[model samples]
Target: MTRSPFTRRTVLASSAVLASSTALAACGGGGDEGGDTAEKIENPDENINPEGLPIVEEEITISFMSRRSNASAEDWNEVAAAQTTQELTNIEVDWGLVNEEAAIERRNLLLTSGDYPEVFYRTGVPSGDIAKYGEQGTFIPLNDLIEKYMPNLTARMEEYPALRTGLTFPDGNIYSLPGIYDPTSLGLRYQTKFWIRQDWLDQFGMATPETLEEYQAYLEEVAASIEGSIPLGGQDMGSILTSLYGTFGLANHGNDAGLIDLDADGKVRYFPASEEYRDLLSFLAGLYSKGLLQQDIFATDAAAFSANGTEGLLGSCGVQTPSGYFGKEGDNYVALKPLVRNAGDEPAWHAVRSELSSIGNFVMTDKSEHPIEIARWMDFWFGEEGAKLFFLGVEGESYEEVDGRDELIPELLEDKTVDEALKPYVLYLGGWYPGWATDDWFRGVETSEQSTEGSKVVEPYALKEVWPAFTFTAEESQQITTIGNDISKYAEESLAAFVTGDRSLDEWDDHVATFEQIGLADFVAAHQTAYERRS
Candidate 1:
């Protein structure tokens, strides 16, 4: 909700608009990698063939697009995130990155117009898009191709059968390669948390808040008693509170019923009209009227809000992740307690949307003849070694080791220390995950002059749980697009108006009615049906 330099954008560098063709001819029967047959990849550097499966000798460029960072585009710098396939499998990536905003339209143009790439290179094609394209003959179903060509990917698929199911269509064939969102995927992504200034709390003799009433009371203290700051500032998670109406808003998942859910089979469900949402709305309206809520919290960008916060100007604000949202500078901050609205509320977890439904990323085209070779090449990106380089940076160059753990180097933290090293160096330009990022990825540069000081500032702390829903179908997805879009737009408009005194909670009943009229009912029904099918 709060904008920042690191913030994900609404637009993308879409190039699926171009139409062209390339051919893939089968090479000799795939041999053991790099001309080695009997030897196994036992050592990190020594192990090459995916357990004796050969490296793709074919030199091809699979052009693709993304809504997020394509570090490859940044400097053509060889960081682990993008270039690992070249390093290990000898596959060259001819990447075509698009801005996030125009990605969908561009993707549609490229495929429908008869032009296609070898594959979606770690592209974030959603299940619906995969299904629609597969149905349209634009995407090749991957079962046989994967079995024949991609042992490593198949092996990973076998390990996570749920992923196999999630990625599978009702017709029972998987149309696209899947990116399994694992546990470590949590702890860093899409967590909506309210950060309160500990230093200010100490100054005002107020303890961290754990309930809605206490939160309100805390804000009053911040506004009236504190000299120059608004009592609280929060956004993003605003939907969670907005849904409850007044009782208890956990502000996780989409929070609004009919927006999203997990059915018996652990697939995504829409839950927009659930009674719980009304309570969230009422409570937020009350906060808006009381001035305990910072009216501009949602309206403000990350820089403005952070500028207010870095100097300790505000008491509380909401954020996606605790890491850089408040500036991850060692243990300068800590979580107080997860909050619940009202006095006798029960504790609840934010829904798994944080992990599930990765908004669109890199995907390949359907025109290539060598699906196996392309898939195999893509497999190397997540290969064990590739995972390490993409996440850990260049190992010895970006990091050092101590006690069998990766740490930062002296030069890495010479400037603002950990912050400078962690941003472009360790993350975007040179990320770590090639095959499968192990727990070791978190242990950055363990043996350094600033290792002692930087680790304290750089260690990961916020909390996020992976969502269960991954592959919602095309039909179900259409329903989601129709209803969720309408409701979300209305909710945002209504919420801002209420907070700014353009409207009042006295008309809360009408707001509820309008939400239902906009097909929130249809949204929830479609999601439930899809959830049952996925299950």
Candidate 2:
């Protein structure tokens, strides 16, 4: 078997000393008096199958730690997906459920106190922590385990090499498994888009905007013609601004304070200090001044945005699907093509979500007693049977196959929405999980035709080369966190000020200078180093 370059033995050998020392300290001593080490559970050769189910002959239980949704059942054993998986694999799970709000603190406490469950599932552990813990031997490296035990995932990695590259750390080891998706799939590629009121466009006899000027002109007309209409209404100001950044030929990179991206020359550039960001802010300020944008865009919540849309007061908005805000009335809205800087210029970008999540979805700790069994157990999710079970639920219960398509039961959709109806059975609806996502489940059952069409409308213009999930050294990660938190808060506040005319754009240069003084250059340099290393 061809192993991933990320699993090279040379890298592991080099770090063995550091790992051993850290492991010893974490265990409180090196001798027998120290904490228990992971033990291999002996199973009969006939009991284990590399590519099939019933992973173990006799049923075995493993401890899993993860955050649970408020709507989900309190016990994992009661959840439909868990129950089905246990039946299929004959591997029971002892779940350690954490409340969503307390997940982060609890995760940190476990890591710090050296008290770990056998596995972490859907805990949203960041890549940096994965690297830090993997190096310290708190989280065991999964490279060899993946190659040896996870044949389904190994085939997937072979088919989509990017999946392996995306999940590998700098030390050439994989510490976690990500929720995988097809990169070219339209549903994942164009997750959110700028939408316009087709009814309002017809009301004014205006065509769909093709360029920035036309887009602004349409908004201006809507402000002048419609009574009490918000030309552009959005609940999240940051996301709304991100949607427009592409028109100015900028990649909507990073979250919060780490707003760095590669330039035309592939050099890292901090966006808040860039000339393109300035132009975008200037255009937005003009929109705010002209009463075309929502008056309380910064303060508007989802409920308020939905209320405005329900009242037919929004002429345009940014959303994953208009149905979320307008219900069936969303049919009046149409997904607008990504507007270009000029009439003939190619659209540069749109909202895109990566096929792989940035955070660790599933990981095994050093204390797992049955590492091989656990690896095989986890691999089930990447195969057809497990994916179907996790995504669609039981064959007849959650969904029924109709003419080769998986469709939700009519009774589930009668009074409740698709999500509300499915929440009781599915563990994480429209959220991240530890499995491969199928386009069949997503497009056929999860989304509506309107939403799929909306994604298709913007699919051609979506950015092809968005930033990859980068892994940083522990020192680099700490520097980024320390500097990024302050920078992100400042940038958001400054953006609000500039748009609302509370802060003059004339002082934009000083704002840029403040960013520089606040270690913007260092932040970009650190990211650049990581990008170059990954390349």
Candidate 3:
């Protein structure tokens, strides 16, 4: 067997790697007591070509576990992209795909039953689980694997330091790969947005509101004029209220206590405890009191919200895109700029999700004998050519170059009776490969009239400052899981009560005190330590 240059030196198991010889023997200890030998299959010397496609010279079978979407081909073997990839790379993957609905349960069962695949693709492992499994020797650390066999991924990490930082565990080893993305895309550039009914504004002979006062007046006027319509509709109170909180300079996401950030003096401060947050709650309470906001703001279901939007019963909404709920009726909605509470204030700060936002897209388990081959196979997808294949599919078949820009042809997107047009290409489109979404992809490409117009309406309002999704150390992770969960639940419950007038604003101090009592200080300290360590 050929040894990989990236052979891991550390103990494959937990801190008890140096346990008694009897115990080690019981655990199938075969290598150095402290360091385990790399598990490998027969090396295909000719197949180790990193310079070209068909990464392995001969056919190599690797088993994979992934969550299957309805859009994906029922049989992973029949997926066009899977077939094409095999044809190109000679990597035959035996896929065990569970439906998305049962994926997590199935994944857990597979892991516990000792029937897990050598690799997991697409179905990301959570941070806590990654740390747990990595420590338990269930998942192999990939830092060494990346350094030796993954030039494409290494180059990307170098380009975007966040990718490496976000995926790295507190133990100073990486456990999984991330789905890298180009953040310059319009969709990647922003997350939460405010969309208003332009048709309503036109009918009422009113202009789009720019300031908080103007927005309040507009909502009031809409409520007074329209019958059976909500002035502001939202999926939840959090989504709608975050827009208000943004204007007040507290970029709060709902239910987070230690979504803490550095204040002007560079000390970690909890935004929810700040004066701005109280003001936000009060403002929302006033809106609720006036019946301008949706009555069922605290409801878990978004069916009513979507139904209202589709029926043109909503004046404005906080949504990622109007197209999601409004469909063709989305044309009537236009994005609202982040309203200023007052003139001369800096841009409003919404919680914008980063495009490099994935926990653990791919992982190799101890069952793998050909980890290097697996790394090489996945590395191809991170490269320029592979990105084209993963996202756009076969150019001439699924997409075509229109005036130098790659666009999915109408045949796959339009020719069918309705949404069935893309069924023929579903396999190609649904093929799983961990990589970046390129500018040519739909999310990146802003060619559509709606996308172009939506960008114009919302881009300028995007905040310069963002709450970075920082990776946590093991200690911090443990503390957050304990204290943070409690604080989040309290915040969510209190937010609903305060906004709905069930809890008095006078009780705000008591609520802040409660957060402190529930280990808020420890939560903030953990985040602060992580932030400074990263710096």
Pick the TM-score winner.
Answer: 2
Q: How many residue pairs clash in each candidate?
A: 73, 2, 1
Candidate 3, residues 1-535, lDDT tens digits: the string is 2111211122112113423422332343121311321534224355567557777787889888888877766786765556777888888988788788887787766765656778877776667667766666667888887887789889988987767767777788788887655666665445456878787788788888888777888899889888988898887876676556568766532222235666667877777777778988898888889998888878845787777788878888776677766778877888777788886776655545555656566888877756778888888778876666666666687777889887777767654422244444433244333677645664322324455466556567655444435567544565566666667777787788888898888877777777776767877887787667766
Error of 2 at 229 (Å): 1.4
Candidate 3 wrongly placed segments (more than 4 Å): 1-46, 113-115, 252-258, 300-302, 415-420, 423-433, 443-449, 465-468
- lDDT winner between 1 and 3, please give it: 3
Could you tell me the TM-score of candidate 3?
A: 0.85
Per-residue lDDT of model 2, residues 1-535, tens digit only:
2111222233334345545644554552122211333334333245566557788878988888888766556776886878888888888888788877887788777776677687887778877677777776778778878888889889888987767777888888898887776665565556567888888788889889988889899999888998888899887785576677678766655222246676778688877788888888898998899888888998889899888888888888887777766776777899888788778987755466666644487888877777778899888878887777776677789889889988878888898876677665666563647777766775332256776788888777776655557778765765666566556767888889999888888887778877765667777888888878877
Off by over 4 Å in 1: 1-54, 57-84, 99-105, 145-162, 184-186, 235-258, 262-272, 320-323, 327-332, 342-345, 351-364, 416-439, 442-467, 470-473
For candidate 2, the TM-score is 0.90
**Count: clashes, candidate 3:** 1
Instruction: Please write out the lDDT profile of model 1 over residues 1-535, one tens digit for every residue.
Output: 2111210111111111111111111121122222231121112222223333345444545454433344334433343444543655665565555554565566656555455554454445655666556555456566765676566667766775655655567677666655444433333322343456666568778777767777777777878877776666643445334323223333333332334655444544333333455456556667767776666766666677666656555666544333354444312444434466555665454522322223233333345544444656656545565555555666677777778877667777775545456445443332312234334564322222222232222223221332345456555565565556556777777666665667765676666667666665666667667556754
Weakest lDDT window of 10 consecutive positions for candidate 1:
10-19
